[model samples]
Target: MIRAAKCSFCGGDVEPGTGIMFVKRDGTVLHFCSSKCRRSMLELKRKPVKVKWARKTREQAEAKVRRR
Candidate 1:
């Protein structure tokens, strides 16, 4: 069984052969679930921390400590 890769931008599951793959000159591999994610990361230069819809953003928010 093959394991599906997660989107590098949104942290969503990326089924095999259904998403875009990108490789940087530094040998880093990136996978995106859709053109929106790819464009946001590559073209718009948006950070996942600032994207409200990204699962990664939500996870990071949930993981943060609430100091009073």
Candidate 2:
């Protein structure tokens, strides 16, 4: 079975057979669920926390850790 990837920018899931995969010169693999994520991380160089559309903020990450 194909595994789902987490978006490097928005922390969203990138389902198998969908989304974009980027490989940097240093061999770092980056996955994006949509063009918005790709552009935000690459072109616009924006942070996910600063983008409201992402909705995955630092607080959410802290909450997840607490829940776990």
Candidate 3:
């Protein structure tokens, strides 16, 4: 069984042959589920933790401690 790759920018599921893949100069591979994610990460330089639709944003928020 082939495993689906998750989008590097949004943490969304990317089915095989359906998304874009980028190889950086450092040899790190980045996968994106759509043009929005690709542009946000590569062109706009937006952080995943700051994107509302990104799963990492929620995860990062949950990881923080709430001090009263």
Q: Give the best candidate by lDDT.
A: 1
TM-score of predicted structure 2? 0.80
Global lDDT of model 2 = 0.89
* TM-scores for the candidates: 0.86, 0.80, 0.81
Q: Please give the distance, in angstroms, between residue 37's alpha carbon in candidate 1 and its true position after superposition.
A: 0.5
Q: Report the error of model 2 at residue 64, Å.
A: 10
lDDT-sorted candidate list, best first: 1, 3, 2
RMSD of 2: 3.3
**lDDT string, candidate 1, 1-68, tens digits:** 77699999999999987999999999999999999999999999999999999999998888784431
> TM-score for model 1?
0.86
* Alpha-carbon RMSD to native, per candidate: 1.9, 3.3, 2.3
lDDT of all predictions, in order shown?
0.93, 0.89, 0.90
Clashing pairs in 1: none
lDDT of 1 at 52: 100
Question: Candidate 2 at residue 45, lDDT?
Answer: 89
Per-residue CA lDDT of model 2 for 1-68, tens digit only, reads 78999999988899999999999999999999999899989999898877777857865777889999
lDDT (Cα, tens digit) per residue for candidate 3, span 15-58 = 98799999999999999999999999999999998789898888
List the candidate 3 regions with Cα displacement exceeding 4 Å.
63-68
Regarding TM-score, does 1 or 2 come out ahead? 1
